[model samples]
Target: MRILVTGGAGFIGGHLAERFVIDGHDVVVLDNFDPFYDTRIKAHTVERCRERAAGGDGSYRLVEGDVRDADVVAELVEEVDYVYHQAAQAGVRPSVEDPRKYDDVNVDGTLNVLDAARDTGIERVVLASSSSVYGKPRYLPYDEDHPTTPVSPYGASKLAAERYACSYSEVYDLPAVALRYFTVYGPRMRPNMAISNFVSRCLDAESPVVYGDGTQTRDFTYVEDVVEANVTLLAEDAADGEAVNVGSTDNIEIRTLAEEIRDQLAPDLTLEYEERHDADADHTHADISKANDLIGYEPTTTIREGVWKFTEWYRNDRDWYEPLVLNS
Candidate 1:
């Protein structure tokens, strides 16, 4: 199948693109190479995907453009069998200061992608939603039925984009599925995220900062499982109009996560506590039963295992982590 993955140059997007490409599918990546962290990292992600595809039977192409560009999105949609809408302004704390930019990219940008898919006769679209859309879950193990009272603009925008996609599915008969991703972590994870920050600080033998006593809990999902879910969603016939949670059922506190990383990287490094960022949720545990039943999705990496994997990647893969000076 021919697949077009927006934000294919991003951490999660790049991983998903490689999965499709390795499966002998024609893959086209649409990315703006946004300066979210460093354009160099995004460029490296694209390069990795190209290299992966080059040695395989599949083909890979990169479309350097924004998801907000209607003409570009429309043109790309016309050439693909499926659309993986993963592009957006993704940082939570940053969104608190720049809500409009998040809205423009996450909300308006999504609408443009949906429009392109609708106009171009693409049958299926897999959207990359976030667990932040659930806000502070009133209950443990957040399910698809959980109320979406997003706390940050970033979460709100992702929820808004999901709604827009659902609306398009209803109004335009565009087959679509929104996968609400939990905390995704792995080798190419974004540097601004907790795992990357902690790893970098540890590598530099500096104390890593923790916010709000670091008690917040999260269900960290691995990149491979996330990519697998996307592939399953793209191929399944019953995925349309469904919003499923994709995550490992295991939940760990932020403090636990930091400790794990510290143990794996540099146990000598201490932690500095700071006030919690308002945009962060207290706890997030995805009830992935829906994903399991619908698409046979199951997370394969444990937090301890994943932490080790990430540490190894950081040490070995020079192509992934060159931008961060974790301790300021």
Candidate 2:
């Protein structure tokens, strides 16, 4: 099958693209290579995907463009058998500072993708949503039926995108599935995220900063599991027009996560705690029963295993991963 992966140069998107290539599917990656993080990392991601494709029966192509470009989205949608929409202005805190950019890229860009898919008769679209849409979670282990009261602009935009996907599916009979991802972490993770930041800081023998006493909990899903969910939904007929959670059922406190990283990399480093960001959720856990039922999705990586893998990559493999230093 010919697959189009939006934001395919980022962590999850890059891994997903490589998997599709190894599975003998032709893949086209669309990314604007936004400067939110370094574009060099994304370049490396594309290079790795191309290398993987070289040994397989599949081919890979990179189309440098923004999802907001309707013409580009339509043209890509018309050519691909399936669309994996992963492009967005990620991060809750950053979105709080620049809500309009989030709205423009996450919401309007998603509408463009869905509209293009609908117009071109694309078979299926797998959207990358977020657990943040559930806000503080009125109930533990948020299910698909849970109300979406997002606390952050990023979450709100993601919710809006998911709603648009559902609406497209209902009104135009488009086959679209929105997968609400939890706190995904692994090698090639964005440097701004908690796990990545902690791991990098620990490796450098620098004290990592934690917010809100480090009591906040998150169901940290591995990138491979997240990619597998998207791949599974691509062919799942029953998942059409449905939103499902893609996450590990395991939830861990932020303090525990920092401790784990410290134990592995910097045993003597002490963590510094600060006030939590207003847009940040206190806790998040996903009920992935719907994903299991529809697409046989199950998270295979434990937090310890995932963190170890990421550390290994950072130390021995990821020569390009430079630790980002942020002002406190």
Candidate 3:
């Protein structure tokens, strides 16, 4: 299989790209190396993909380009069997500062990808949506049927992108599946994420900042589990034109999660509580039954296990960390 993964150099996308390559599928990664966090991390991800592909029967190609470019997206879509549209301007807080950039990339860029997929004869497109689209959930474990009342520009952009994908699926007969991923964390996590920030701070003996009262919870899905859900969708046809939630189904309080990380990485360090951002959701719990029914997706990583694994990686992988001063 020939697969195109946009934003393939990012955390989740990188994992998916490497997994596909290891499974003996030709993979093409298109990433602009967006300066959201650090481009070096993305570059390292691409290098890892190259290393994995070197030993497998599959091949990997990295194309440094933006997804917002219609010509680039169309040209790449023409050569792949499946398109995993993972490119976007991520981060809720950052999006709050600059909403137009998020719209241009997440909404308009998604349209470009879908339009190209439609123009070409690509049947399946897997879009990366977010649980943020649900806002403060009226009910626990948000399902696909939950109302989409995005509280942030990031969430709004994702909702718009998912709508565009579904619209293309309906109007052009292009099969599209939008996977609303919960808070994902694991190896190669971006520095801006809570888990990564907490872990990094703990390692540096710095007090990890806890936003809000810390009672707010999140359904933290491991990166490997997310990759599994995405890979399963490639072989699934029943989920076309539908939105599904990809999560671990294990919701944990932010404070609890921070304590776990601190205890595991720095037993002596304490966490500092701070006011939460206004755009932050009080909670995010995904009802992943739809994903299970559609793709037989089941999460296998617990919070403790995921944190341990990430801490282990962080301790051993010094190359990716050397560029940034942890305590500074």
lDDT (tens digit, per residue) of candidate 1 on 47-116: 8888888899889999899988888998899999899999999889999999999999999999989988
Ten-residue region with minimum lDDT total, candidate 3: 319-328
> Which regions in candidate 2 have their CA more than 4 angstroms from the true location?
324-328
lDDT of 2 at 218: 89
Task: Tell me the TM-score of each prediction against the true structure.
Answer: 0.96, 0.96, 0.97
Q: Which stretches in model 3 have alpha-carbon errors above 4 Å?
A: 322-328
The most accurate candidate by lDDT is: 3
Question: lDDT score, residue 108, model 2?
Answer: 94
Give the clash count for model 2: 0
Q: Candidate 1: lDDT over CA atoms?
A: 0.86
